[model samples]
Structure formats: structure tokens, C-alpha cells
Target: MDGVSPKFVLPETFDGVKMEITGQLGMIWELVKGPVIVPLLQLAVYICLLMSLMLLCERVYMGIVIVLVKLFWKKPEKRYKFEPIHDDEELGSSNFPVVLVQIPMFNEREVYKLSIGAASGLSWPSDRLVIQVLDDSTDPTVKQMVEMECQRWASKGINITYQIRENRVGYKAGALKEGLKRSYVKHCEYVVIFDADFQPEPDFLRRSIPFLVHNPNIALVQARWRFVNSDECLLTRMQEMSLDYHFTVEQEVGSSTHAFFGFNGTAGIWRIAAINEAGGWKDRTTVEDMDLAVRASLRGWKFLYLGDLQVKSELPSTFRAFRFQQHRWSCGPANLFRKMVMEIIRNKKVRFWKKVYVIYSFFFLGSGQGAKGNTKGLKKFPRIFKLPDRLNTLELGFAAFLFVCGCYDYAHGKNNYFIYLFLQTMSFFISGLGWIGTYVPS
Candidate 1:
């Protein structure tokens, strides 16, 4: 081999040297097989068991709550009523109050126009609406696009302003803080924040503004977000279902139970005064929205969850983008736990059950049987362990019931529920592995 060319040969001076290329290759192969593989295989087994347990646990909890609510708690007989404004009323009277809509952008050139157009077309008095393009784009192309869009809106008599900062100090949070300091938004009554990917309906303000108007004590109103292109792929469809579960069931249930609910960052309106009173936005955690919501709620500020109003946003269509989003969410919760859990527990204003839910929500950070289950795949079958077979028959029955219900919800539209469930279970296994992938050194 050496006679062919020196270039193709190992250095002659290092001839006697024994290099552990195989060892390095073995390390690489260990990623595919070794302690990591062993645990992952074990995790797969435990995941099946834990999933069964979780199924049972959720069903029992939900059943108990339902029975208690029905037997003891009196259901509110309140009915929703819509009252449209009269033409005779002063345009300034009930028509339009000062509303500052803040659109936060970061490297979102692809959806910039759609977001801007949707915002500009909001059905509100032009004079009363102040749209601030809070652009923190490091890319010149994105910056130019934002400027041009702002100019176009200005020409059309829309009160839109473009803002750019030299450096992104606190990322999205910093952009918002700096924008708030600007005199333009100081006197604004309410501020609506939208991420670059969100395209709110024209009547979003018309629908949500009244809640703030009628309820003076309300600090924020969060509208449900719907994905516009959810049917684009299997990944997006699953995401849409997950989001539906969150907004429709979890958020509503939490709000109705007077438990802690969070601002989802975008598609929400905050009273400028309420934001100021809650100490404005802070950059201590990656989930600035959640941090602010919790701080404000603990500070005696009330939040309204507006179920009727909906804002449309794009879902991450690829597994890569979805994984990135989930990773950030997971890390944000971890960071929040580090920063605020103790303070939350110590707060006298938060209710006991709310504290429990907060604790439960933060349990995702624990290295428990659940985490292990989440990290494994079923492909390594036979090794897949059943969650403790010692669970009482009643517990197993309850688990089966809950599993069926969750499966029903997830497979509502599918013609073959079993296939759908299998695919979904596999996708989750893969995604969970992706989550664990974050901890691996590159």
C-alpha cells in the first residue's frame, strides 16, 4: 500500500506508533451500541409500563375531578352575549382606544409580509392603532424587508413604525423592553404582541378588546392559536392535535379551575399598565412569556383566557424544526424551575391546588421512570417491559380507559385508529429520542 504513493500511506516516522483508530471507531459505534444502547433498550421497556401507568393516573384524576365538579360545584349559568358598536357612537367613544400592536421579528423574512399584512388589516381605527415593528434582525435582507413593509403600510395611512436595534441584548425580551421605553407606546392603553409567524384575523381586536374594556382588572387576554397549514404533513397534523389538546382542554381546564395558566407569547393582548405593574418583561428565563405571566398572577393581576378569539400561526412542518421548538420548550421549563419554583411556592396568593399543578408541570425535569420511558423505542421489542404488573386490576382497568380516550382524541379523523395510534406512538418515541439527543455532546 505504501509503494503506491506516500500521500496514501501513514507517515513512515510514525510506523511503530500504535494508534487507537479502532477505539475511536468503537466509541462512535458505542453511540449505536453500549451503555447508552443498554439504557435506551431498558428505557423502551419501562416506557411501555409508565405509559400504561400514566394512562390510568390521568383517567382517575379526570374522573374524580369531573364527579366532584358535577356533584358539588355549581356550574355557571352565564351566557355569552355579543354587542356590536352602533354607527352613531363617536368613533373615539366605543370604537377605538389607543392600541399598540407589537410585532416581534427575528430572522423571519419568509413570513414577514403575511404577518405585516394581517396586522395592518386589523379592523380598528387607523388613528387609534399603533403598530410597532419590533425587528431584531441581524440579517440585512430581513431588515430591508421590514423597512419596506413599514413604509408601504405608512403610505396606506396605517400608523406603523419600524424599529431596529444595534445589538440583540435580551433577544425577544430585550426588543420588547426597548420598544416599551420608546415614547410612542407609553400612552397606549393596550399592547398586542405577535410573533413573526402569527397572522391574526382582521377582527382579532374587535373580539378581544371588549374583554379588557368590560373587565378593568384583567391584565391580559390570551386568544387560542390555530395552525393554518396543519394538514401539510403527518408531523404538522400531530402538532395540531397536540396544540388543540393544550388550548382546548388543558388551558381551559386550568383557567376554569383557577390554576396557573401562562401567556403563550403571541396572539395575546396585555394592558400596558398591567405589564408595567407586573414589572414588564424580564429576560431571566428563555420562556419570558411564562415567567411574566406567573409573576403578574402572583402579584394579584388577573388574566382572562379568551376562548372565542383565535389567531393563526404556522406550525413547524419538519421534524428538525419541531425538535428545535420542543428542545427550547424543555430547556425553558428547566430554567424556570431553577429561577422561580421556590418563589412560587412561597407566594401566599397562589392556591394550594395551583401549587400542586405547578409542581406537576415542573415534574418533566425529573429523571424518573417517565423520562426513561420517553427516551426509548418499541422497535427493540421483547425487551420492552410492561410497567409494574403488580398494579391492581382496577388500576389497570382505569389505565386502559384513559389510554382509549387519549387514543380516541388523537385518532378522531383517522379511518384506521390502530394504525394511527401505532404511527403516533412511534413518532413520539423518535421525538423523545431527539429530546435526549440534546444532552449528547456533539
Candidate 2:
């Protein structure tokens, strides 16, 4: 006591003493994670369960649809051919109006060269083709690179114009709208939109232009997206199979049957008048492409899904990139549900079955949530083992039956039928994930 000499003492009610005590308690609570932890866990579990059920239902529905579609759908054997436009002189002589090719980009430096090269290589008359580079890049390097590319192409007398906005008002959709405001775009009778990543085949215009010329009411033509680097990795391979199934079978069948076919964002040509009448591209959702298509359909503007016309684009090479793309797509569908679903259902112009298909397709966006659910539910309820096991058994049985039938058809010298059946079976499951993954992100 003599050595301590009345050590300094602070009252519990003093500000410094109170603050020190409270800080220590806060640290202890932080380590413990407090009462909200249990509630957050509960909410998460509920979300997982709901998503799982939705995904399960979607997959089951897709499985059934694949079977029905295959059984009833028949490919049109008689090919409808269009006269080929062989040379620059022929293209120039053709009475078809000027076509505006708008290529929109945002930080796509890696793929920009290939895309621009593809555009320049398009088999269309240089005089009639107007190429608008809608670049929205804050990065000086990307801008400089694109500007130089544009200049190089311009020197070759490829009617190319480069434009960039001061700010991206609504991302891609805004950039496209701004591009349309240019006077050069106003002179065009049709517009062909391509993403920065796509490399369209040289004959794309030759093949697609004829369709618009033949059909007066046709608003847009969506060419199938084929992955140029599907075999790059496991993810890319899976994506390739998925796209093959989608473009080759599902979209073909859907369009042939006059069902609701969503407009793919790229590799498509649009009639300028139809787009104007349908109110151009709306930026209400991230997927301006689909939104525009649906609105155009609702307005009685027809769309053509050209199965034979292929536009190659790079699939996301990594899981993270793929996941981001999927998330954007999923959220877009949800947003579309709020924006267009009710109006579509109410519209007298759209057929009843088309509205139903729109609902079905919208549900397709929720499929990733289903994958998330399946992964979680399998972990949570071990009894759910029966679900996947049952599905596997059913899938195996179906495949086996098809194999036997295919062999029988081959023995009967119905070789085409046999091959068709085999391809159908293979594509059915391969493409089925599009619907399943909508509800399950994983």
C-alpha cells in the first residue's frame, strides 16, 4: 500500500471508464456473432429450400418437354433456298436498302480485333454497309486501340464510323440508342446488331437479308449463337454442348412450331421500321435484347429465328465469368416478369400459347436457383438421394430404349431416323441444364 501510494482510481460512471468497459463488451459480442446469426441462418435455409423445389420442378418439366417435342416435331425436309449474292457488284445492284451494322463494345480489347475483322469481312457491299462502332470505354488504351482499328478499316474504304459517349447512361442499351441517333443510321433500311465478342460469318448478311426482303412484317432475325472456343476448357465444353442443344434443337423446334422464341442479343438483323414502331430498345432491364424482342412480338411485329445462320462468339472461359453472365440473365428475367409478363398476357395481338411460352421461358431464367437448391437440399436432407437416383435411373432407361430403337431402325434401313433419334437423345439431356440451372445458381 505504501509503494502503490493510492493508485489512480476511476469511477464506473466516468466517461472514460464507461467507454473502456463498453468496448471490451463489444469485442466479446463480435467474437460471439450475437442473436441475429441464428435468424440469418434460418432465412438462408428457407431460401435454399424454396430455390431447390423450384429447380426440381423446372428440370422435371424440361425432361417432359424434351420427350414431347421430339415425339411430335418433324424437320422440314424440303429446303427453302435463297438466291446467293456472290459479288460486290451483285450486292450493290440488289434493290435491298442500306443496312446499318452497329457493333457495341465496352472494354472488349481482347476480342475487338476478331469482331472488327469479321465485320469488315462480311459479304456485303461496302457502299451500302454502314458500320457504327458504339464504343463506351473510359480506359484510354481500349479507346486508342479501337480508334486505330477503325482508322485502319476506314483506310480500306470500309464505311466505318467510331463514336463514344461522355457517359454510359444505361450501359449497352444506352450505347445502342445513342448510335441510332447518328444520321448515318437513319439512312439504313435494316440494322444488324453484333456484340463485341461475336465473329459473324461472311455470308451472314447474304443469308439473313433475304428473309427480311421476303417478309414485310418481320422485325428481327436471330441467328443461332455458336461458340468458337467451346473446347477450350471443361466449362467451355459444357457450354458448347448446352449451346448446341439450345440452338440446334430447342430454338429450332420452338421457332418452327411458332412458339415464343426469345431474341438472342447478337448476330441478328432488324428492320429499321419495325424497331421504330416497337419503340427501339428499352433499357428497363439489362437484357435489352430479349426485352425488345418480347415487346416487338407483343406489338405484332414478327421475328425470324434462322437455324441455318450461325454467328460464332466466345463463351465465358471461366466459371466466375459464366456465373456473372448467368446472374445478369437470371435477374433480367425476373425484371422482365415485372415489366412485360402481365402486359404480354393482356395483349390481344399475342396468341394465348405464346403467352404461356413466355411464362415458361421466364421460369427458365430461375433455373440456376434450382441448381443451388439441389446442391443444398442434397446436403440438408439425405433422403433426397432418392430424387437424383430416380432421375438417373429414368435417364439411363430412356437412353437404353432409344439406343435399341435406333439399332432396330438401322436394321430396317431407316438410317436417317436412327441417327436423328440418337442425336435427339444426346441433345435432350445436354441442353436440359438451361432450365435446371435457372433456379440453382450452382
Candidate 3:
């Protein structure tokens, strides 16, 4: 007992070591503490999670609906044969409807030749078909080349016109509207539009025009896009799969159910009357095509999506192009939704279910547009973390559940899981920032 009382240094050292460890752990917690508002940030995180869940549910529903349609629905009498339905007598007759093929271009030098060449090759009566090349190119070289190409096609016995404006007032949509103003177009019965990058098959008009001709109520017939550069890179491949899911599953379901889906800005044939009836093309919004489609649909016109009539187009080969495209997509829909939603609600023509779907579709359409690495509202997001970081066990568990779901999805062969993961991770940054920026303002 005397010896033990004489040496208690070990116990003191042990207590000192314990205090040091406690201090280090406190420092670690402080580091994770980050900015304050941990609770608010956690709430924001949960809200994001809820949005993600909604997104997932919508996708699942679309997939199921599309699959069921393909499996159980009767294959209608729709034809996909490349052989012209018109027999020899009808083919020879000059009574075919006047069709104007419009190629909207804006410095699209890379793919202009392919598109113009393809348009010239469209199998329609030589006199009845008018190829209008709307060249809004600012580049003198590109403009000259485009004009020369139009000349070359005209020399080949094709009725082609190269038109330019003093100024690109509305960019692409402006040029298209201006083309429609020409005296030549007034006689055209229908207008087939293709972006500069799209190359429709020779049967493009043959397959799509009949729908408009036979069904007077059909306003627009849109064809599915098949990416020409899908094999060029992993990004393109990812884009291809995503677009396929959209066209095959979502668009098909819309077609089967008569839902209100908009035109893809290209590869569509529009009735001249329908275009005029729907208030024509207005450049108030950047997504003039979708705006026109929605307006036309609201005016009791129907849209037909032909998944079989594939339009091969080049995907934007660079990330910068893809990003800008995405940004435009997100913003345009939001802008249109903002402008037209009240009209949609007040309109008597839209069915209740259709209205619901349209609202839901565009809300997410705008929301889903903002994603990873976009610097929009990048500053506002960090302020939510201004509170001390306090870990919420329940929320942490929910996050872990998401993690498991992602893992399960990857295991189940959605190799595009990487894309989903990247989007989800950046959703709070980009998506949340967008909503806050739009609604909350400065």
C-alpha cells in the first residue's frame, strides 16, 4: 500500500492522454462542422432527396407504361415501309400536296452539307417540293459556302432558295418565321423542318406526311432522333441511351396515351394551317418549337410521334456544346412554362389529366435541366451551411438508404448509374440553386 501511494504517475499520464484524444476529436467535429445551419442544410438535403424520389417514381411509371403498351396494345396499321405508298399513277400525278422543306441554320458549317444534301434528296415531286435554306450564319465564309451549296443543289434540278436576313432578330426561330413570310411559301400545304445537323432518310416525308394528310386533325408529326455520333465517345453513348429512353419509352407512352409532349425543335413536319392557327412561331421564348407545339395542341390540334421514322442527327461533340444545349433546354421550358401555364389552366380544351401531366412534365423539365458543374447560383448554396454541423442520425440513415439504392441499381445493370450518381451528387448544388434563384431571387 505504501509503495502504490508512492507512484501514481501512470494514472496521471493516462488521464492526460485521454484529454488529448478528446480535444483532437472535438477538433475533428469542428472541421466537419463546416458553416452553420447544419439543420437547415440537412432539411435542404431531405427536400432534394424527396425530389429525387419523385423523379425516380415518374421514370418507373413511364417505363412500366411503355412496356405494357408494347406488350399488350394492338399494333395499329401504321406503316414503316420505305417503299412509297403512292403507286405509279399517284407518283406520276402532279396533284401531290405542295411541301416546303425548311432547313434552319446558324453557323452550322460542320453539318450543313449533310442536311442540305439530304433535304435535296427527299423523294417528292420536283416541282411540288421547295427547299428553303434559312441561313442566319454570321460567318461570311460559312454563308458563302451555304449559298454556293444551295446553288449547286438548284443546278441539280432541285427547287432550292438561299435566303438571308439583314439581322438575326430571333436567331433560328426568327429565320424560320421570316422564311414563312415569303410569297412562295403561301402556296405550300405543309412545312417540314430539320435542324442543320439532322439528316432524314429519303422516306422521311413519305412516312410522316401521310399522317398529316390522312388525319386533318394532326398538326405535327415528329420523328425520333438517332444519334450519328453515338459511337464517338462515352458522353455521346450516355446521351444516346438517355435519348433512347426518352424517345422509345417516354415519347411512346405519350403517343399511346395522347399526352401533351412538345416537338423536339427538329425532325418534324408541321401543317401550314396548323402553324398559322397556333399563332405561328413566336420568338418570345428560346424554345420556339415547344412553344409552338404546346400552343398548337392547346388549340385542339393533335401531335403524332413516329418512333419508327428515325432521324439521324449528330450529337454535340463537345462538353461545352452539350452544356450550353442543356442550359438552353432547361431555361426554355421553364420560361415557356412560366408564360403559358396559366393559359393551360384556364383553357377549356385541355383535359384534367392532361393538364396534370403537362404541369408535372414541365416543372421537372425545368428542374431537371440544371445539373452538375453548372456555376449558376453556386454562391447561394454554401450559405445554407452557415450553421454548426450537427449530424442527424435519421437523415444520415436516409442518405445511407439512397446510397444502397444506388448500389443496387448499379448491381442490376444500369451501367449509366455513374450518370445518375453524378447528377444526384450535384443536384443540390445545381438543381437547388436553380429553384432558389428562380423563385427566391436575390
Candidate 4:
């Protein structure tokens, strides 16, 4: 009797309670879905569309400004005190400014010799020119090879030094910084940087040095990059086109209007005084070049970009390498913006418009023109209807117009131009995905 009594009946109410809770939750979601969730999503879409329009407007505005400037812009020689250096026999080799050529390498086994040879072959006085090979290769074999190459150049009476460090503390930035600390470099009036892949002409020094030598106010002389392997693959060809646009339009505009542009990290010469005044290179971000340029500009230092004086360099051939390169190019600027926005705002040396240009036009947008387009395609293209149809049509029109202009410029008789145009279009779509690929964890 006690055992039977202990087996009390359990309430069958659990299923009913869960069903009631789920029904209430569903109702709540429906209630908030229209007013709260939908509006929030619509607001996000609107914001994205607005950003896209702003970027598009800036692109167009810059284009117009470039055209107007080219109409009557004074050449550097006209504005600055540019006197061509006479022959060594006439002017004397001792009168030339001492230059420190720094070639930074990191396991670049294939191109080290080319860069070293090109630099040593520069048409400058042997006594006045100092070539520094900053080899930060972790691979011992690569390090040995680079050192031997430097020694080989040294045997030819070239004043080239082979430099190594205990560790790659700041990566490329640290190596460059250390290279400047040498006792011999103190004698140098200017410093030129070359990446491992770059091969400058023998007269590179003869042409670029005059700008820095003549213009005391100019902090840096940035040269254009010409890709040696642009025809190697479709990826390389696309990169060539994108970079061509950057050097041709953006750099030219910056140099002409603001007297400023990002130091392209290599194939550029920096006055030693300007480098010290800007506090040298800091490794706070991956983009040491842009960081230095910003700091230097804030200190009232100006930069010059010579579009005609192009230095030959190799582009990344593989997708994996290209992805990493794009990640650095895209993310580093954002990171630099985050760090330097306040500094830029507080600087009194630069004018108000210069500050605006740096923050709004340079860092906020990006060095590459394609990033904004790519970003828009990724974020705003799907929900583009959040904005007016007219706005979308305007952007499409601009794109189509640019395409037509490019065809007119390059597609006269060359069939390769057609292939290049198609590759560029393909490049745009694929690079748009990089916005996602770059940030996502590998």
C-alpha cells in the first residue's frame, strides 16, 4: 500500500509551457521585426550607400582637379632652384651631395643580386655614394648569398656595406631605421631606399638627386614604379593597371596640389635632415612608409613625385602573395588612420585644407583607387536600393565613361589592350572579395 501510494502522478504541463513560450517569442520577433530590425537594416544600407557616394564624388572631384592643374601647372624646375649637375670634371665629384642607398631585403633570394647590382651601378661618385644592404633574412642561406653579393660589389671598389641584425624587431622598418644609425650614414646628406625587387637605372641618382638637391624644402622624391613582370600573368597585368592609375593620377595630383603624397617605400630619396626631423621611421604600423610621410608632412616637410622617373619592380605572381600584399595595403592604412588622426588634427604646421586632404582624402579613403570601388561593390551593391535609383545610375555612368576613355587611350591598334581591359574588370570583382578575405582569420 505504501509503495503504490508513493508512485504519485507527474504533471504533463512541460510541453504546453514550452509551446506557450515559443509562441510569445515568435510574436515578439514579428512585432520588433518591422519597426526595430527592418529600420536598423535600412539605416545600415543608407549609411553604406552614402559612404559609397562620398567616395565616388571624391574620385570625380580629384579627376577634375587633376585635369585643371595639368592645364597650367608649373614644372618642378620652374618652381624650385633646379640646376643640372655638370660633368664630374667640371663641377668636381667632391661638390656632390653624399647619398646613402639602402636596399632592404627579407629572404629575397631571386632578386637580391639585381637590386644590389643596380644600386652599385648608379651614376654617382664612388666616394660620395654609400650603398647599404639591410638583409633581414631569417634564412641563413639567403643571408650568406646577399652578403656575398655585397662583398662582390665591394671588391669592385663600391662603397657598399652588408648589414645584419640580432633580430627582425621592427621588420622592414627596423632594418631601415638601423641602417640609418651607421656611422658612415651620418656623412650622407640624403638616403634612397630600394626594395629587393626594384631595379633602378644607372642614371636614377642623376635624375632624382637634382630635385632633392635643388629644393631644400622638399623632404622626399618619390619615383614611379614600372612592373617588369606585368605581362607574366593575368594577376600581374591587373596589378600593373591598378598601380599605373595610382602613380599616374593620384600621386601626380597629390604632388601638384598639396606638395605631398605617400612615400612609396622604395625608389625614393629622403633628405637626411628631413628624416631626423620627422623622428625617423616608427614600426607602430605595418605601413612605415606612409607613417613617416604623414609625420614628415606634419613637420612642414614637402614631397615630390616624379611620374616620368619610373623604377622597375616585380609584382606578386601568385594569388596567395597578392592577397597578403593587398591585406597590408588595405589594413595598414586603416590602422595608421586610427593611430594618427588625433596627431593630424592637432598639428599646426600644416594648413586646414592640408589636414582635411590627409584625413579625408588620403587616409580615410586609401592610397589605391580600386579599394573604394571594391568596398562599394562588397557592401553597397546588394542593398543599393536603399538609396535613390538615380544615385546608382550616376555611379554606373562614371564607371562606364572611364572604361570608354581607357579604351580610347590604349585600344587604338594593340589587341593586348583589350585583354588588359578584361583583366582589369576581372581584377575589380576579385579584389572586391579581398575586403572580406583580408579581415577574416586565416
Candidate 5:
């Protein structure tokens, strides 16, 4: 015993101990599985089913609201005070509110001319309109091309300024923020923003500016996007479908009912006062447009969606580009939600329902829509391959129907209170799962 413990145990004793330990561990596992594992699995299943049901209900409710919206939604001119601006006889185009157009681009070799041309051609008084081309292109050749395009437009009697920053600090948001810091931007009462790919109509300004001018309460006038190459490929087609739903159903409904909707990054006009009051732009999240919109909404500002005022734009035709776009679209809002949920909850300026709509409907549903396309819901099943496809189609149809229904609901409520609850716990989970799946690299 003094030499070390002469052998601690006999082989037979060790074997007995091992057997007893194994039995105890097995019993513990069984108990754990029965009470803990099984219930967790069941809870997961229930959550999935509940989410499916909630999304389905949301689709239905949106369908009904949008349908009614299309049939009877009044034109903006009818709802808001609007009047065509005319030049003063002596001053001649000097009385029009100075408007600033911002085009933010980064190495956009292909669409630079188109966007610049479209903005230059806006039917505002030449003396009153100023266009800012925020070029963040890293490629020297592309930068040269974009700057040349701006010069070409400038030579045509258009008041255009080509702007470049030392670095892309905040990506698009940073460029936009810098663009506003220019001394000339202060003289402009209203600002219109277009991405490099957007080609607004000639009358885009005439159509959009009046809403901001006539209504002091309105912060933004967001226009619908029309993709010229929607039929280019399957990917673009899917994008078109989703974007159409976003513009038609989601944007329209939010504008009609709540006077709120996320400010799409492009093809929109903003009241400079509202932007200033909303603390300008913060580059905290990738979805800077949505971030600004939420901040503006919380400050008691309203947005107007112009469904008929369509602006031509292009969708990402490649899978790689689409994945990146979807990732930003999905993740930015979730991050923004996490960042601003408390700010939204504590704001005393907005009503209870509006806060819910922003948190539940705008943030959740908007983020969910981006992830919904890339989800593989029933990949585990081989027989019912068409189920997810059918559900997607049904959802799109519901969105289409709801675009029409939002028109109806706007004109007539018709027991559509349920629409308020369409997006709830289920949407939050879908958004989270979708965000995780799309961008988490393999």
C-alpha cells in the first residue's frame, strides 16, 4: 500500500464498474430523450407549421387588400393638394423649387449613361434642377467612362456635377451622405435619388415633386420599378416577380393604409426638411434606405408610393449577383431591426398599430420576402416536389390579388382588420432562417 496502491482494482471489479456506469448513462439518455429531445422536436415542428400557416394567411389578407386597392384607389393628385408648377413671366423658371437629383454609382460601366441621361432629361426647369453624380467606382476606366458620361450630359445645358469621394466608407449610404454635404445641396428643397441602373421617366420630377411640395407631412415619394429585362433569364424573372409583389402589394398597402413604406433605394423623391429632421442618413446597416425610412417614420413623417409612376430599372441577372443582392436585402433589415427595435418601441410620436406595422409588417415581411425566394422548404421530400412551387405561386397570386385588395381596403375597409396580424411570430422566424441560409457560406 505504501508503494502506491498496489493495483487499484481487479479486472473483474473494473468490468463491474463499467457495466454499472453504462447502465446508468443509458437510463439518463432515455430519460433525457423522452422529456427533452422529443418535446424540442415537437416544438420545432409546431413552429414550422405555425409559420407556414401565418405566411399563408398573410398572403390571403394581402391579396384581398391589394385587389380592392386597384379597383378604387384614388390618384395622388386627388388625395393630396397638387398643382403644376409654372415659370414666372419675368423671372422665367426661377420661381420653381430648386430640385437636386442624386445618382450614386460604383464602377457602373454599363448603365452610367442611361441613368445620367434619364436624370438630365427630367422635365423640371433647367435653371432649378441640379444633378449630383456620386461616383464611387474603383476602376479607373469605369470612372473615366462615368465622368465622361456626366460631362456629355453637362455639355447639353444640364446642370450636372460629377462627385467622387476618397473612399467608400459606408458604401452607398456613405456616398449618399457625402453627396448631401455639398454646399449646393442646401439650396435644393427636394432631392431625387436614383441608382446607376434606374432610368426615370421624363416627367418623373413633375409627377413626384408635387406630392412633396403640396403636403408638408409627406417625407418621401417612392415610385414603382419597371424592369426592362425581366424576361432576360429565370433569375431575373424571379426577381421581377418578387419585386413586383413588393411594389404592388407591400409598398402600395403600406402607403394607402399607414402612410408608411420603406423608401426604396432608387426612383424616389425626398423632402430635404424631412431628411434633416430624421437625422439625415446613417451608414450603420447595408439597407441604408430602409434605415433612413424607419428613422423618418419614427419622427412622424409619411411616405407616398406612386404605383403608376414607374421607373425603368434592371435586376441582377446572374446568380452570384442575385445572391449578394438578396443577402443585403435580407440581412440589412434584420440587423436594423435588432439595432432599432427598442427605438421603435419607445417612440411616442407614432401610434401603437403603426409601430407594430413597422416592426412586424415592414421589417419582418419585407425581410422575409427576400429570403422566401431562396428557401428550399421541401427538399427532403421527393414525391411532393411541386408543393413548394405551388405554394410560391399561390403566394405570388395572393400578392397580386392583394395589390388589388389594398386598393379595395383603402377605399373600403371590409373587415380586413385581420390583415394587421398577418405578419407575426412566423414571419420573424422565416426571416431569421432565410437570413442564416442565404449568406452563411458553405
Candidate 6:
């Protein structure tokens, strides 16, 4: 006490006072928590239930929209269909309008040859078609392979150009824009794009270019993607189902309803005029394809999705790759959504429905799709003692039927169940630390 400062020394009664206060607070907490804890839990559960209901209603509305679309949605009629080997006399010359085929590649050694070769083999008039391979591969060996492949195609009398940049400044999108700068590309009226892995059919140019040539207002002709390795594994199969829905129901609905749908980047043709008008490809967001499409749409350009024309491609074989792909897919769209929503709303050219559709889609289907739902304590149930197989099937079927009447999804498929299982397996909670401060009751 003699060595201690007056402020540092405690009163003789401090210990007793502290003990009494602590005990009193502990007793109060116990009493409050007993009465409060259960109701708080019940409140959380109720909130979860409400969110689930909202999600279910949203799904039903989507289902209803899809059904309505299927009942009566028609794509535009082709004024003139393109033939691979044959000539179109009405298109002026045998070669007709020049087309620039751009293949953007980056460390795609495994699939570059297939894409380049396919692009070369595309049955357009030899002189009229110009194939551009935009290789941004850091791997010198891969870059050489791509160049050699281009040379091989060129030697065979195919009009192909191999392009490289000192730096991948804009990555894939930058490479594409650089490819368009060549002197030969100036004559090209329309541009067709394929990702490095996409193995488009020989008739790709013929099938996609007709719409562009026939309709001056049409800015892009997007083709559906077909996964060649869809049967390789469960992951690919699930992706296949999901993509099938996207191409068929979602795009179909978008086209029919005149709501906004976007380019898949690869396997789509863009008019050079439209590209120029829309400010070319800006790498402001990860999704340059969709960004370009939206801008073009806002500029009074129409996009046509050809459902009948399918371009085969590979799906991500590994989960790590798939997760990265998901990140890009989710984050890019959301980024673009954030960047473009206000612009879209303010744009007088964009239809009201289209704006709403884009907003809702970016809000609900962005990264939020991966956020698992309100199963709560249901995950603790024994996995081994599941419902009987037959009963499970019957119950699922009944649920599906009931949902169909109200409009929603029931887990009838094995993959659907697997997804639920995956979600359960991955669930955990982290307590967020916050400051405990005094507050007045509102």
C-alpha cells in the first residue's frame, strides 16, 4: 500500500462489493436467459421458415414463367439459312461477307488444337473466313503449340492468323480486342467467337452467321453449348442438367418475353458494327461477353439465341477448377450487376421488364445461389436411418405433385438429394463478436 499510488490501491470493502455485483449479475443473466433463450431460438426458426417460404414462392413463380414460355414462345424465323459447302447467290458473291473468327486462349494447351482446328475446318468460303487465334499463354511451349497448329491450318489453305501480345493487360477480353485490330479484320462484317476449349461443329459459321446477315438489327447470334464429357462424372452431369435448364428454359423465356439474356462469350457471333457501336469489349468486369451484350441491347441491338445449333465443349473435370469457374460466374455477374443496374434503369432504350429481370436475376441468382438454406437442426437427424426407399420415392413424388400445383421444386432426382447432402455436410457456424453496449429500448 505504501509503494502503490492512491488510484491503484483498492478500498478494503472492494472485494466484497465486486463479489456481490458479479453474483447479482450472474443470477439475473440465468433468469433472463432461461425465459429469453427459447423464444429467441423460436424467433430465428420462424424467420428461417419465412425465408424458406419466400424462396419457395420465387421458385414457383419461375416455374410458372417457364411453363407460360413453353406454351407460347417463338424465335425469329431465318430469312436465309447458311449451307456449309454450298453458295448463297443472294448474299452477292460465293464468299459473301467476310467473317472474323476469334479464339481467345490462355494456358489452354490441352484444348487449343481442337478449337483452332475446328475453327479452320469451319466450312466457310476459304477466302472470306479469317480465323484469329488470340494466345495469351504464359507457357512458351503452349504458345508454340498454338502457333504451330495455326500454321498447319494455314498451310492447308485455311485463312488463319496467330496473334500474341507482350502482356495480357486485359486478359481474355483484351486479347479479343487486339485481334480485331489487324488490317485483314477490317473487311470482316461479322465476328464469331469460340473459347479455347469449345469444339464447334464445321457448320458453326454457316448456322450462326445467317441471322446476322439477314437482320441488320440483330447484334449477336448465340448458340447453345453441349458438354461432350457430361457423362464422365456426377459433377459434370449436374452441370449438364443445370446448363440444359439455362439454355432451354431460361434463355427460351428471355427471348420470348423480350427480357434480357446474355452472351455465353464463346460460341456466339457479334456484328462488328454492333461491337463498335457498343464501345467494343471493355474489360471493366470479369464477364466481358455479357457486359458487351447488355450494352449492345441498350443501344437498340437484338440478340438471337439459336437453340438448334449446339457447340460441344468440355466441362470442368475437377472441383477446384469448378469452384474457380463458379467464382468467376457468380462474382462477374454480380459485379456487372452492381456496375450496370443503375445505368440500365436510367437508360430510356431498355424495356421496363428487361431492367426488372436483370435486377432480380443478379440479386437472387448471383453468389447467393451457393448460400445454403434454412435446414437448421434437421441436419442432426441420423443419415443411416433414412426413410424406406419406396416410401421415399412415393413421398417425393407426392411432394413434387403438390408443389407443381403450387409451383416449386421437390428433390425427385438423385443429384438433387446429393446436393442437399453436400449442403448438410458443409454446414458450420462462426460466432460474430460484437461490442456489448448500453442501449435504450425503442
| TM-score per candidate | 0.69, 0.68, 0.75, 0.79, 0.78, 0.72
- Number of colliding residue pairs in each model: 4, 18, 6, 0, 20, 0
Specify the highest-TM-score model's number.
4
Return the lDDT, model 4, position 250.
Answer: 86
Residue-wise C-alpha lDDT for candidate 1, range 257-337, written one tens digit per residue: 666678989999998888887888888877888888878887777776766678989988754465456655655666777
Ranking according to TM-score, highest score first? 4, 5, 3, 6, 1, 2
Expressed as tens digits, the lDDT of each residue in 155-189 for candidate 5 is 88999999999989999989988989999888899
Model with the higher lDDT, candidate 3 or 4: 4
- Runs of candidate 4 with Cα error greater than 4 angstroms are 1-28, 88-91, 367-442
Against the true structure, whose lDDT is highest? Answer: 4
Per-residue C-alpha lDDT of model 6 across residues 45-134, encoded as one tens digit per residue:
998788678667757876888887666655355233433335867764555678888999998878998898888888778889888989
**Winner by lDDT between candidate 5 and candidate 4:** 4
Better of 3 and 4 by TM-score: 4
| Cα lDDT, model 6, residue 205 | 77
Give the least accurate 10-residue stretch of model 4, judged by summed lDDT.
433-442
The root-mean-square deviation over C-alpha atoms between each candidate and the true structure, in angstroms, is 13.3, 15.5, 13.0, 11.7, 12.1, 13.1
How much does candidate 2 score in TM-score?
0.68
Q: Give the whole-model CA lDDT for all candidates, comma-separated.
A: 0.72, 0.74, 0.78, 0.81, 0.80, 0.74
TM-score of 4: 0.79
- State the lDDT of candidate 4 residue by residue for 1-442, as single tens digits: 6565433533336667788999999999999999999899899999879878988997897799789868888886776777877566766887789999999999998999999999999988899999999998999999999999989999999999999999999999999999999887778999999999999999998888888887888999999999988877676777888888788888989988864689888999999999899999899998999999999999999888888798999998755466457767776787899999999999999998889888876676784442533333323234434554223332344345546756775757454565565555445534433322223222
After TM-score superposition, the amount by which residue 135's alpha carbon in candidate 6 deviates from its true location, in angstroms, is: 0.5
The reply for model 5, stretches above 4 Å from the true place, is 1-31, 375-442
In Å, residue 404's CA in model 3 sits off its true spot by: 27
